[model samples]
Target: MHWITTTHIAVTWMLVGLIWVVQILVYPQFSRVAARDFPEYHFAHCFRIALIVVPQMFVEAATAVWLLHEGIRATPFLISAGLILVVWLSTAVFQAPTHIRLMRKFDASLIHHVTLTNWIRTLAWTARGFLVSFALS
Candidate 1:
């Protein structure tokens, strides 16, 4: 397999793993943060998690596009790219706003929304990762 494919698979799995952590551990933990302390906690959470998440997402998306650009026009590659788009859009439209709202205070509804809506991303990235893994093979 080519290096681009290798990078794509690696980054996709990284993102898949990260989303699961955020979904299972981090988001659920938000409920446990004290209400008074939550604003600071949420801000810190966003800032720190961004440090880990953003670059991996960027590399995954860019490398997927690069693979498509290089003429790997298979169903799986196209499907993986499409899933990446869904993951990005869900994060932007749904997840980010929920987190921003969460920063104000720990609203249980907002926390629930963030936790639930994140399934879109978590599952999407997993599918993308699985698809890309096959593409690597």
Candidate 2:
């Protein structure tokens, strides 16, 4: 297997697992945070997650692009790329706004919305991880 494809699969799997952790463990804990301290906590959450997120996203994206350019196993590569797009779009369009509201105030409604909507990303990443694993196999 090409290293690009292998790296892409690895990074894709990382995001898949990380998103699940965020969905199951992190986001659900938002409501438990004291309102007065929520903003600071939310900021740290956003800041720290971004640290892991932004670079890994780039690595995944770069590897996807490289794999596409390599012109092997195009179908799986494209599907996985499309799923990555969905994850990015959903994160920016759906989740980021919800996080913003939480940063401003710990609204349970926003927390609910974020956690629920994040399933889209979590499932998409799951599918991506499966696809890339198939590619590796």
Candidate 3:
């Protein structure tokens, strides 16, 4: 496999692991944060996670586009690209705004919504991880 493909695979799997942790462990625990502390904690969480997640997301997306440009028209590659799109769209359409609301105030319903909606990313990345492995094979 090409180096770009390897990098893509690595970044993709890293995101897969990260999303699962966020979904299962991190988000679920948000409601437990003390009311007075929630805003500060949410703000810090956004800043720190953005530092890690944004760059990796960019790299993963760039490599996916590069693979398509390089003539990787195989089903696995195409499906993986589609899954990447799903993750991005879900983040933009659902997750990001929800996080913004959380930053303003801790609503138990919003916490639940984020936790529930995050399955879109969690499952997409999980499927992408498997699809990329198939692409390699």
Best by lDDT: 3
Off by over 4 Å in 1: none
Candidate order (lDDT): 3, 1, 2
lDDT by residue for model 3 (37-126), tens: 999999999999999999999999999899889988889879989998899999999999999999998899999999999999999999
Q: After superposition, how far is residue 74 of candidate 1 from its true place, in Å?
A: 1.4
Off by over 4 Å in 2: none
Of candidate 3, the 10-residue stretch with the lowest lDDT total is 128-137
- Specify the poorest-scoring 10-residue window by lDDT in model 2: 69-78
Worst 10 residues of 1 by lDDT: 128-137
Which pairs clash inside model 1? none
Assess every candidate by TM-score.
Answer: 0.97, 0.95, 0.97
The number of residue pairs in model 2 that clash at the backbone is: 0
The per-prediction tally of clashing pairs is: 0, 0, 0
